[model samples]
Target: IRLRPGYFPFVEPGFELDIHCLICGGKGCSVCKYSGWVELLPCGLVHPNVLRYGNIDPDKWSGFAFGLGLNRLVMMRYGINDIRHFLSGDVRFLYQF
Candidate 1:
């Protein structure tokens, strides 16, 4: 896992969560796009404006958020190549689980 600076609209300070490529074991590979990292999610502190919109006071509260890409997670976890297999309305693939 690696933590680096990032940015997102909804958060004041943002971050990206990338895991060491399971396929490459931290080595550069096609699966990791030769960067050796698989981007999985994004996180950050809640923006004050966003918090205000939710009826929360920025001065009184602070928090962080993470956006998980389920598709990516599934692909990484199962080593899936074609995203269609997961999004396809076909039940055949679901049966594998």
Candidate 2:
């Protein structure tokens, strides 16, 4: 995993997490879109202002956040070629999991 700069109103310092494309094995592939890396999540340290708004004291409290891309994760895990397989409501696809 690696961190890249990002922007989020609720966070002081934000980042995006990227992992080498598992499907491509670091090579260009449809799953990787030829980038050789996959963006799996956005994350960040909690902003002081956001802490205060949540009734927490910024002076002592701190936090971090991460957002996962579920669809991407699934594709990597199962080597799924088409994302629509997840939403197709087909028993054959759903039953695989």
Candidate 3:
């Protein structure tokens, strides 16, 4: 529903956020993998001390992050016979979608 810039240890800069799909109106949808939403990205500001600790300038650096659930969405879209098919390398099933 909202996105905010922040920081994380693993990433120089991090962001936390939530998104609603216009197509689904926040309801479950094939496009959203029945989760009713999609991830935009996780991005944030680089800590001045963190950049300096890494020997990089805080002023010149920035970053962002996000994740996708590709397989889940595919299943929802096609009504696949099984989730295993996605990784099973079956051409027949893949073509239908």
Candidate 4:
């Protein structure tokens, strides 16, 4: 995914977009805290002026991003009942899978 930086009244360099999480195929998951994503950082190329505004050169910088949520999906798929159960290593549940 690609994102562009723009000015927002509240933020110095506002990010208008972010990448989708690979896990759950962006559908959402328990591991992602039901957010369907693991990473929650806003990503984008810093605006040239914004770069200068922060005393950094925009001409020399670029960025890329991706995210995942493995555990949440595992809980959702296996009918784990509770997230803590997975950690307990319960024999009954392990046998079912």
Specify the highest-TM-score model's number. Answer: 1
Give me the runs in candidate 4 sitting further than 4 Å from their true place: 1-67
User: Compared with the true structure, what per-residue lDDT tens digits does model 3 show for residues 1-97?
Assistant: 7766655665655666657754566787655567766555555554577667888876887544355445545554555434578788879976876
lDDT of each: 0.82, 0.86, 0.61, 0.52
Residue 5 lDDT in model 3? 61
Steric clashes per prediction: 0, 0, 5, 2
lDDT of 2 by residue, 16-97 (tens): 8889888888787888888888889988989999899899998998999888989988898899867788889999988888
Would you estimate the TM-scores of all the predictions?
A: 0.75, 0.72, 0.38, 0.31
Question: lDDT order of candidates, best first?
Answer: 2, 1, 3, 4
lDDT of 3 at 75: 52
lDDT of 3 at 30: 59
Give me the runs in candidate 1 sitting further than 4 Å from their true place.
Answer: 28-31, 69-73
Instruction: Point out the worst 10-residue segment of candidate 3 by lDDT.
Output: 63-72
Evaluated at residue 61, the lDDT of candidate 3 is 72
Better of 1 and 4 by lDDT: 1
| Model 2 / residue 62 / CA error / Å | 1.3
Candidate 4 displacement at residue 73 in angstroms: 0.4
lDDT tens digits, residue span 1-97, model 1: 8888787899978889899877667787766778888778899999999989999999999998998877866766788756678778789889877
